[model samples]
Target: MTDQPTPRAQRFAGRRVIVTGAAGGLGQVVAELFRAEGAAVVATDVAPAEDVVACDLSDDAAREGFVADALAELGGLDVLCNVAGIQQFAAIGAITADALRRHFDVNALAPLMLAQACAEALVESKGNVVSVASISSVMGQPYNAPYCASKAALLLGMRALGVELATRGVRVNCVSPGGIATPMVEAAAAGLPADTNWDLIARSTSVIPGFMPPADVAEALLYLASDAAASVTGANLVVDRGVVW
Candidate 1:
């Protein structure tokens, strides 16, 4: 087979990327994938680690500082992947204002703020952004009102920004994943009532029969952030295995 044409090189070669929530789970996977694809990656998380820049995204000063540090370290930024989020499950009457605000702060506001901080750099580099939303953003899930609302807001905000930034050559998109088999999902499931019908809730809407993996979502992000998707701004790529349907 003529050596299969020697396969092309990694897609993100020479690109500078910033990935938030890189300490674990989906964020960590996305960051590693970018690095594997030959991108210079600045990985940030709330907890400090030898391989991560610590920044609590809820704090405005810290968030801004993290962006500055990421840019300084990377020299330039071509892609930003906002994958940090919080999820909690509680009955409507049990949901506290603090919990609701926490979801919005981390899931919705932080992504928007990061996008704002990186806007100029993205414009200059003709870069792109990919945010991780949730399938619940489109289809409501019981006992997850706050989480769903926050993700919905994030999804719409990214779409609007995609429009506003198109002329500036900065593309923005979102990836909505459904029931990814991660520690985060396991923890969320553990918090649910013992009587909860997880079977019903986890049912797939597509032909696929199981939970998606973090890497599936990461690949969707890669496509949106890569030059391969040059004309695909203002879109939400649903990696839910057709769960919304």
Candidate 2:
């Protein structure tokens, strides 16, 4: 007897989604998750890849234009996943203004701008927004002042947006993850000073131990974007393996 092909789950079938930072580690996984669940996805990032739109999220005009282009292409938006971010580790005394600006621009401001741009469409569809925050938002980390502050701002903005949009039937939420095995984390680790105490940092934060895989984060995003989480809004789901606790 011939084996029957497994039917694919269609949680987001007939839905339209816009995923920013599509070229980044977590962003790419989030986009793929939406697409696999049958959503029409428009993925944008600073670097272009096949089917990924090249757009810099840091620029105001570029961000606005990207959202417009995405909506035009997708016809409308049902979900917005803000998954792009940058992490730079620098001692507070050594950090430059440019460094701080870069972190906030990409990590905090861009997500707000994208959400603002897509507000009308998302409201029309009764859609949702999911942002990838960080465990750093709630906990201090060595040489990561800018990153933690930016993520904190992002999380707060998401909560405020959730409350404001709740009356309109739009949900907004964020996911805070601990160390995940992503290129971004690797790059941050590589840039760390040789004298940094890796053991101490790990011992303090590695409550559950080991780096989480990107897929785990993607699954969290999927849940927030799916109907299963319809009643969930203004929520911050921590996927850092008990590190935050």
Candidate 3:
């Protein structure tokens, strides 16, 4: 008898996926994980990678073009991971209109637009979406008014989308992370006070021994995008090492 072909890993094995902000940090890791797990990952960012498409998230034309090209290049899309975001340290009194708009454009509005464009394809594939919110959605943090507010809005948006798309078999979920060690964090750390108590903050937020690496956040996203999470939807998986609880 002829040998049979190997069984596929899951629905992801042949599916096309779109990951925004895919050039760096958590976005890069998340895109890589999906690719490793057998998805045809269309990694996208304003600054493209050799294997990714570069498109500006804030530009309406660029966002539309990305959706169109993603469909054309990948044949169709199965998952959308909205991992592009920006953060600013501004107290409520110090929050400028430009600063807040920039944060919202990247952190909240971009994801919503991407989702709107991909919803029809996702419904066709019965695929899911995973967004990257932050722990600040649930807890208060000083000197980050706009970032926190934008993340909170992202969480709510995920919930609403999950409900609206339920009957169509499209699931929407998000992951909230605390104190992830990315280049952005390194830059912020360089500006900290001489006596900043880093350990205290880590211990307070993370139930895990070390501060979370980007991979930790990426894996959480992979789970939400996988068939293992088939019954899961409208959930915000908080990977803060137990910070909010």
| lDDT tens readout by residue for model 1, 103-180 | 999999999999999999999999999999988788878778899999999999999999999999999999889878
Candidate whose TM-score is highest: 2
Top candidate by lDDT: 2
As for lDDT, the candidate ahead, 2 or 3, is 2
**How do all models score by TM-score?**
0.92, 0.95, 0.88
Q: What are the per-residue Cα lDDT tens digits for candidate 2 across 1-245?
A: 99986665899999999988888688888888788889999998899987799988999988888888889999999999999999978766778999899999999999998999999999999999999999999888888889999999999999999999999999999999989998888888665666887875774476677888898999999999999999999999999887867
Q: How close is candidate 3 to the true structure, as a TM-score?
A: 0.88
lDDT winner between 1 and 3, please give it. 1
lDDT of 3 by residue, 27-143 (tens): 888887787778888888888587878888889998998899889988988899999888756445666899888888888999998999999999998998999998988776766
User: Of the candidates numbered 2 and 3, which has the greater TM-score value?
Assistant: 2
Which segments of candidate 2 are over 4 A away from where they belong? 1-8
In the order shown, the candidates' Cα RMSDs to the true structure are 3.1, 2.1, 4.7
Q: Model 3 clash pairs?
A: 207-241
* Candidate 1 clashes between residue pairs 3 or more apart in a chain or in different chains: none
Which of the predicted structures, 1 or 2, would earn the higher lDDT when compared with the native? 2
